[model samples]
Target: MKCLPSSLLILAVFPLVVVAKRRRVPFMNCPSTKSSSGLGMVKQARSRIECSVICLNNPECLSASYCKSSDGYTCQLSQMFLAGGCSGLPANGDCTQTFVVYPCENGGTFFHENRTCHCVDGFIGDYCHRRYRDCQETPLGNVLYTIQPFRSDYTFQWKCGPFTSPYTRVSEYASVFNFNYTLTWEQMKQGITPHPGFYFTGPETLHQLTKQGVYDLFIRMIVLGKNSGYVIYKHFRVDSEAEGYACHWKSFTRYYEVPYNSDEYLDGLGALGDSTKSMKGARFGTFDNDVSECAGTHNFAWWYNPLGCTLVTFDPDGLNWPTNRTGTVEIEKIDHTLIGLRNVYWYVEDDLIL
Candidate 1:
């Protein structure tokens, strides 16, 4: 038999693996409720499912109200959400019904009976758009909105896992962050490109630094199928705009320390920082754009270093924890991360961990 090339042989041995897209049921039936808002596009639909299909086709359509009239059935698409309680539908019973169309964020469960979203542990708000941190403060606009603030220190947890390629399409392996900010999938589709790793937007990160005084930054990273982990518990201060959303810290304290002396170990995050390597200035990188160098090669975004040695990452292959510093062994992969940030002056503990 003719010999096949090594590359072809390898391909034959292991067939190409394909990832399937996730199925999304975007709407749920609310038989007892109808939209209180004005009518939108009125169309003829055979059934409520057809009305849902019509609403699904229109990206701007938030909900669809189907009414049974003497002539026939009419499908009315509206941008207003189908909230709970009666909508004054003339008490016609099942003659009129509404379908709420939207995905709840952060692994929230939508209850069709009341049109309410029961959010995950760390998130709250109507659509679970806001973090539980919002419960800490009372807004100026409303007095009734005032809630009992958390009296003592608290912690919130969010878990991120590995996801396969293509990243743009929603999959079973995709990570849920917030509202439309679902990591890996929705972000790529919405023109936001980043690896399926934990990250905070530049604006959000900057907002946290706006509070004056020292802040305690705590990061806990656990390897999958392992008992041990790494933790960065220290105090830091941010010099806003000093770098591309990168800040400075007082000490590099961690549960597991790097080798005592190793030339390969440049800094905490390799050559990402400025010339001084004090983390004074650094820029983030994405797969499309290599602002920090080598980010494109990894097919992920981060404060990368051309020289390697990554301190923290949610990427399975990108978590280089510095065993390579002394040429002992390769850095292990990190699969889970929990981050907490708190201002020294303020008594609140904010969970900015993605």
Candidate 2:
């Protein structure tokens, strides 16, 4: 076929972009422990002195009230104005809210302000969107998936997502899992063309798994609730030098690119929670072509898509696991003009547990 074009490939990628989109921005300034609904939640500081508990302690407390009898004060959280304060205001101090704290990849806690929380890797915005593709947050729920990663011929850093298990397959897109020690090169070669669950980094050139041998991949995503399962998106034939030149993918990165609007894959989570499964059934996406490849392989890599869906995934936490989840995929046959090979192909690999 056409050897990937030059300059055009490099331009395929640009700096990352992050924006803000929420129903009403559920922010709070009071310590009432109730979600801020933009309405009057806190009774309003009964007296100016008790306001300290609501205002002095948390600068975000724009309004407050006192339970004259309970001897306690409740603070009404104001709209989180610019991380710290509103423009020109005297600036009370740091009013950053401290709620469900999760550990970011590197060695820090996720960022939280104005209600929306995200990772700390230079990412600042709704759901941690403003950062390199490698910086998106990977919500590992309660299932506690524990598995190691293996490589084919070539591999890169950002290309690796946390795999709770390793799998192999044979198809045009490679759909089935062969695991390790059970398949041979001839078996793998004649097995499937492209294995399912294939994901890749954002690069201009195509990256082929530098090593063309048997490789297993372990991937994990944050699934909410007990039997909920998240789609595993992993890239294969990656880390190859020639593939890099072909795909022009140098800075490998992946993001949630999840679709939140679909019925198949929805973020079932109820917005905020304490544990991964407590994610409240946050959906990930639908099994549509956006999440499939053999169908068309449209690069719908971002999570929380405007049209995508999310669902409660198999709790990766120790409490619950997807006992009924199953994977569905398409298997097709194609005659790749370049290789002069008429082969049955399978793409858009996915695993779903009911």
Q: Can you give the TM-score per candidate against the true fold?
A: 0.35, 0.19
Tens-place lDDT digits, model 2, residues 225-265? 32222322223223332222211111112224344211122
**lDDT score for candidate 2 against the true structure:** 0.24
Model 1: lDDT equals 0.41
Number of the top TM-score candidate: 1
Best by lDDT: 1
Full-model lDDT for every candidate: 0.41, 0.24
Stretches > 4 Å off in candidate 2: 1-41, 44-71, 80-82, 85-354
In order of listing, the candidates' clash counts read 0, 100
